[model samples]
Target: MFRFIWLSDQRWGQLEPHLPKNQLGARRVNDRRMISGIIYMLRTRCRWCDCPAG
Candidate 1:
């Protein structure tokens, strides 16, 4: 089974569809990713270059 918790950024979905997309060509891929990353970093105490940032 899978468990899920709403991300902080997802709470801003109401404004997503209204924003422009980045160079990645995503009009709204959900800011949840950025928020989630930041949150995970806080919990892991890992440097950005240690993983994704690397």
Candidate 2:
């Protein structure tokens, strides 16, 4: 199957600065991956629970 990556490094670099820091809890290590999954689901019109696990 062809893999889809919605966020490129350059795009993520631009976006990363605007995202809020996680100060109150443990830092999330997979924010980019999680956002990519979300974008893939939205673009593909798949159900949230049906999104593939990367």
Candidate 3:
């Protein structure tokens, strides 16, 4: 079975500073979830559409 991966608070803290903020568009919500999904996809070599819902 595949295990879901999530970003830790410390890791997110380190990454939070590098992410774009308050851009001229819709607000970026669920940034951590989005990043975690991307990381999961890359690590598991799974298709984006095949990713399991949280």
Candidate 4:
């Protein structure tokens, strides 16, 4: 089974400033959640659609 680990507040604080803002379209999902999902998929070698929802 895959274990999901979320980003800590401190890490999110450090990373938040570097993420780009979406100015033209609808607001994007939470960066931390998106990044966590990506990392989980990469680590588990799973398809994007197979990744677990938050």
TM-score, one value per model? 0.42, 0.72, 0.77, 0.69
If the candidates were sorted by their TM-score against the true structure, best first, what order would they fall in? 3, 2, 4, 1
Instruction: Residues 15-40, candidate 1: write the lDDT tens digits.
Output: 56765666675355546666566676
Q: lDDT tens digits, residues 1-54, model 4?
A: 557978889988998999998677877887898897777778878888764565
Of models 1 and 2, which has the larger TM-score? 2
List runs of model 4 lying over 4 Å from the truth.
52-54
**Residues 1-54, model 3: lDDT tens digits:** 778789999999999999988789876779998998889899989887885676
Clashing pairs in 2: none
Candidate 2 or 4, higher TM-score?
2
Best first by lDDT, ranked: 3, 4, 2, 1
Error of 4 at 11 (Å): 1.8
What CA root-mean-square deviation does each model show from the true structure?
5.6, 2.3, 2.4, 2.5
Clashing pairs in 3: none
Candidate 3 residue-pair clash tally: 0
TM value for model 4: 0.69
Better TM-score candidate (3, 4): 3
List the global CA lDDT of all models: 0.58, 0.79, 0.88, 0.80
Worst 10 residues of 4 by lDDT: 45-54
Q: Pick the candidate with the highest TM-score.
A: 3
